[model samples]
Target: MNRRKSREIAMKLLFEISINTNDVSETIENYKENNENFDDVDFAYVENILDGVAKNNEFLNKTIEGNLTNWKLSRISKVNMSILKIAVYEICFQEDIPSKVSANEAVNLAKKYSDDKSPSFINGVIGNIIKLK
Candidate 1:
């Protein structure tokens, strides 16, 4: 599958876990049962992202919460928030990914999965973060 498609699946799984407050194992099992097309690498990426987010949630949330304007982290859509978290994690910890790529991918994910305002909002916040970092 394409990278964007992989990211979308990863984001969706992350959001579902966030909304449902489900464990990673359960989520992975559910995905395995539900998505016939999922492969090992795709599962690996999703697991890595989810684990990274969980491991660094406090720092990630604080970073994201700081960048957002007139909005609290809790107030963001689950989809948008998940997208941001994964991208921000990539920016902060995944040195292999360029910060610009992470930010752009995040904005695209926001546009694809969130409201009309979400893409720009994501871009602005991520831009601010890249600048500050």
Candidate 2:
């Protein structure tokens, strides 16, 4: 599939991992086994995101927390947090992907999976992250 779709799946996987605290590779393997459309997805991209984000979660959280004006990382919804993690991972680690694109995709994911206010909130956080980067 396209990068957008790959990101969507990665976001979902991140959300699952955040909640379940499962082994990343095992979770991804199970997801692949269950998902019929797995063939279309860019597994390389997804795996990179999953492994990178998992490996660097503490740093990512600190970066996100530092960028926040008044909110704690715990205050953010899990779904929004997952979205932010993916975007942040892309911005910080994926040299091929533009920061703006990562931020935009994050806002799109928030709009789809989070509440109405989440899009703007995510946009603001990502904007701050881009500025800091």
Candidate 3:
């Protein structure tokens, strides 16, 4: 499974949802409409993660809040926040994918989308969550 591609889609969908509070299914449908050849494998990942995160948002936010040191989830950048949500979802909910993979992918997303410091900041937060777990 090309989880990185899936993770990328998950993050994109999650970020979009965070912004406008659109329906996940609708947003995904729109996403699919735009991106050609997104394929079933990738779409499944996007749908699963988008659904998973939405299903447990309150709990996931609380878990992320608990792991944050002197910082609230809202304080983080939207880009990093989106990445963190994906990572934390994988960490706290999805057991098929390892925590380390989630953490690494989050850092990569941060490096790709967020400011320079986001990678380390995200790494630290994810590391703390791993330690706590």
Candidate 4:
């Protein structure tokens, strides 16, 4: 199902949605149009991640905020938040995927899309969640 691709698309969409609350549907449509190769599975994954995050944002943030070792949710960059939200959503709700896989994917995304320190920070936060469980 190309989970990595799905995670990337989910992160991108979440970044946009977090910045601009309105026009998320339009944005998703535009993303689909740009990535014509995205099959139904990819589309569904992206949609589910976005929908899940949106529906449980408060809970997700609370989970994330509690897991932070030396940071606050407010201080986290939007890019990191996007990655963390997806990983956290999967860890807490999407029982099919292993927590380690979700966490590693999130760390990879943070490394690619955020600062040098982001990968470790993301890994640590996701790891903390796993420990809490």
Candidate 5:
């Protein structure tokens, strides 16, 4: 699959992990059955995102909460929040992936999966994050 498709899948898997709060391993097993096109790299990205977000949730949420202008973290949709978390993590941690690429992919994902407000909302949060860091 292409990079964008990989990211889309990763976002979906992360969203799944967010909503379910089940064990990651079990969730992956179930997700895998439905994902016929996934490869090891795809799995790595999903696992990295899911585990990284879970590991750094407190810090990430704190950072996001502080950066949001008027919206509370809890007020954000779970799917949009998951997309933002994964994209922001990539921006903050994955030096190899350009911040611009991360931000663009996030906007694209938001446009595809979220409402009209999501792209800008995500872009603002991520822009602030990149600025702060």
Candidate 6:
């Protein structure tokens, strides 16, 4: 799959791991085993996101929390948190991906998986993070 589709899968896996507290590698392997369409999914990118976010969970959370305006980390939904973590991971750790692309993909993910207001909230927070970078 394309990067966008890979991102979606990564976000979903991240969301699942966030709630279940499962082993990221194990969960990814299981996901791949269960899903028939593995040819299109970018497992490398997906693994990068999953591993990157898990490795830098605290830093990512602090970065996101620091960028939020009048919002606490605990108050954020799991889906939004998952999306934010992936984007933050990409923006901070992945040198090849542009920060704006990360931000935009994050907003798109929020729009698809989060509530109505989540898109703008995610955009604003990511925008702030990018500006600070």
The lDDT for every candidate, in the order shown, is: 0.86, 0.92, 0.86, 0.89, 0.83, 0.93
Candidate 2 runs further than 4 Å off? none
Candidate 4: TM-score? 0.93
Q: What would the TM-scores of all predictions be?
A: 0.92, 0.96, 0.93, 0.93, 0.91, 0.96
User: How many clashing residue pairs are found in candidate 4?
Assistant: 0
Model 4 C-alpha lDDT per residue in residues 64-118, reported as the tens digit of each score: 9998977878999999999999999999999999999999999999889999999
RMSD of candidate 6 to true structure, Å: 0.9
Every model: Cα RMSD to truth: 1.6, 0.9, 1.4, 1.6, 1.7, 0.9
Which regions of candidate 3 deviate over 4 angstroms? 39-41
True lDDT of residue 54, candidate 3: 89
User: Which candidate, 1 or 6, would have the higher TM-score against the true structure?
Assistant: 6
Sort the predicted structures by lDDT, highest score first.
6, 2, 4, 1, 3, 5
lDDT of 3 at 25: 92
Best-performing candidate as measured by lDDT: 6
In the range 15-86, model 6's lDDT, one tens digit per residue, is: 999888998888898898888877778999898889989999999999999999999999999999999999
Total clashes, candidate 5? 0
Off by over 4 Å in 5: 39-41
Which regions of candidate 4 deviate over 4 angstroms? 39-41
After superposing candidate 1 on the true structure, give the runs of residues whose Cα lies further than 4 Å from its correct spot.
39-41
Model 5 clash pairs are none
Q: Give candidate 2's TM-score.
A: 0.96
Residue 10 CA displacement from its true place in model 1, Å: 1.2
Residue-wise C-alpha lDDT for candidate 3, range 12-71, written one tens digit per residue: 888898898999899998887887765534777788888888898888778878888889
* Candidate 6: residue 121 lDDT (0-100): 98
Best by TM-score: 6
